[model samples]
Target: MQRFDGRVALVTAAAQGIGAAVARRIAAEGGSVIVTDLQEDKVAELAAELGDRALAVRVDVTSRADLDAAVAAGVERFGRLDLLVNNAGACVVTAMPEDTTAEEWHRQLDLTLVSAAQSIQAALPHLLKTRGNVVTISSVNGLAAFGNLEYSAAKAGQLAMTQNFAARFGSSGVRFNVVAPGTIRTPNWDNQPDALDRLAKLYPLGRVGEPEDIAAAVAFLGSDDAAWITGHTLPVEGGVLTGPSALDLTPKGPFRKEQ
Candidate 1:
């Protein structure tokens, strides 16, 4: 369970949702986690909850300076970096390709893709020192045709970046991989009516994912168990990507089971 006892992990957007879940999971498994998010108070609270094993930093991943400072602070606190979870991202708006404005496209690319690249660059030295790994939070949207065109494109870039890093850093003892989640139950759907229920039906498992589901996958990729695993995309989506949803494929008439 303590796969990362002496390790230090830096997770962005750690204030809530998948980010927070990843931070919590890492900390629970005996890792020192640097929880970075735009919300200073929430980050501080979460850090407090995690006790001294967690450090909070206000980092706007879009800002290179902020990311550098966060990485610096983590190294200063934990002495080295073992994992970097690029979790700060959002689907700002959902629109068809034609309806997506240039501004939105750039924003999506910068936050979801470019930020991860910058963070990796900043953490590279320390990671090299520790022979650490990077596990980025991508999405199933990137693996298949889903809504949010700009977001999907940016997320796809994360997967590509992982492969590039894995190929380039494999000899260096550093690994890179991605966790592509499908319809996770996060705060982003808070205002929607029966959102989890609606989304659950679309998954082959008959239920959507919880943030912890993705967190578990991330823990594996970041742990020593995954020492040989790199450039891989682990779909932690309750079987959404496996095939068609059972809900959508139920037999009708005589083939249908009696209720």
Candidate 2:
């Protein structure tokens, strides 16, 4: 039998990029998938392409109503919910910590942190009913500080939430875990030359990661193979976090310490 033959999955941000890849993979493994995004048209198109195995729903993850509705639609269509992938997120390229505007900060947090919270909250009942699992798409920035303050802060919040939720639901047979992807190549990478190069060099593998790479990790975590895993933050970073240090990349010098 296929690995996910009778499962139902709901993936956010499924119109494109990593979320889309994950949705496709789950469906390919025989799961019924609800592919949701704020971009209704693109999601609808992707859902259509996936045929009877997929359903498309328009959802703004930040909105509780939208998230609840999406979950309801999933249950109504698929008859049960077995997995929820909270993959919708956003980032802000700010000049400095102080320069980060309130609006930008809120937007980053709302999209990256609160959005996942809302989705998980809305899906909890159904997840509990099915003893389902949650696979959240966090970032390496959550574990270590990246220069993008807002993005890092929000992702950190997401990681914390993942752990807390896992602890809360673990006894009930619900599993929660995070897959933190480093420097993945997606449609969002266009026009960021400096970032792209820096990220590539940071990884021990010496190249940026691909969306499918992250998707594969998420798929594994959502499947029965990872049944014993929960509340863990797995880094799918191509050794970026474990690679050579900043000092190694710089010229050797007896650097002076500030008094």
Candidate 3:
């Protein structure tokens, strides 16, 4: 449980939900975590809850300056960087794929994909120094037709990016992997309370996932236990990816109304 003792991690989007859970898990296991998010107050509250081992940084992942400052701050405080949890992505584009505009697509990619790459670049030097690893929070949507075209595409990009980074840095003792999750009961679902109830029926596990479920997988991937693993995507879905389900992803399902 204390596998991360003496290690340090930098987690993006650590203000709430899965990001917050991962930050809590890492800190609980004796890892010093740099918890960064655009929500300054939220991350600061989380850091306070996590105690002295946690540092709150308001990092706009889209900005290289913010990413660089966060990485620098973590290193300067924790003394070294051992893990980079790329958990900042989101499904910002609600429009149907065909009707989605170029600007929206760019914005989606900027938030969900490009920012991840920028964070890696900002942390690579420190990761290289510590022989550390990265655990990117992708989505099962990336592996299947879960709708949210822009989001899924961006999530899939994280997988490919991790693979390439793994292959490029494995020899240097740096690892990269992804955890693709199914629908979770995050604040994003607060308004769509019924949607999760309906979606759970489609999953073989008969329920949805929790942020802790993802944090557990992230802990494994970012820890020494998964030292031999690299360039892979681990689906932490509630067996939803096993086969077809009753979940309707068609434009007429719910997206058209939201659009």
Tens digit of per-residue lDDT, candidate 1, span 32-126: 99999999999999999999999999999989999999999989988999999999789878567897778888989999999999999999999
TM-score of each: 0.95, 0.91, 0.93
- The residue-level lDDT of candidate 1 at 187 comes to 85
lDDT, each prediction: 0.92, 0.90, 0.92
For each of the candidates, the C-alpha root-mean-square deviation to the true structure, in angstroms, is 2.6, 4.6, 7.2
Tens digits of per-residue lDDT for model 3 on 1-259?
A: 4989999999999999999999999999999999999999999999999999999999999999999999999999989999999999888856777889999999999999999999999999999999999999999988988888999899989989999999999999999999999989899999876999888888877888999999999999999899899998999998888864545543453453343
Rate residue 31 of model 2 by lDDT. 92
Instruction: Report the Cα lDDT for residue 82, model 1.
Output: 95
lDDT for model 1? 0.92
Estimate, for each residue in 86-162, the C-alpha lDDT of model 2 and write its tens digit: 99998867668988889989999999999999999999999999999999999998988777889999999988999
Instruction: Write down the TM-score for model 1.
Output: 0.95
Lowest lDDT 10-residue stretch of candidate 2: 243-252
By lDDT, who's the top model here?
Answer: 3
Instruction: Answer with 1 or 3, whichever has the higher lDDT.
Output: 3
Distance from true location, Cα of 2 in model 3, Å: 1.0
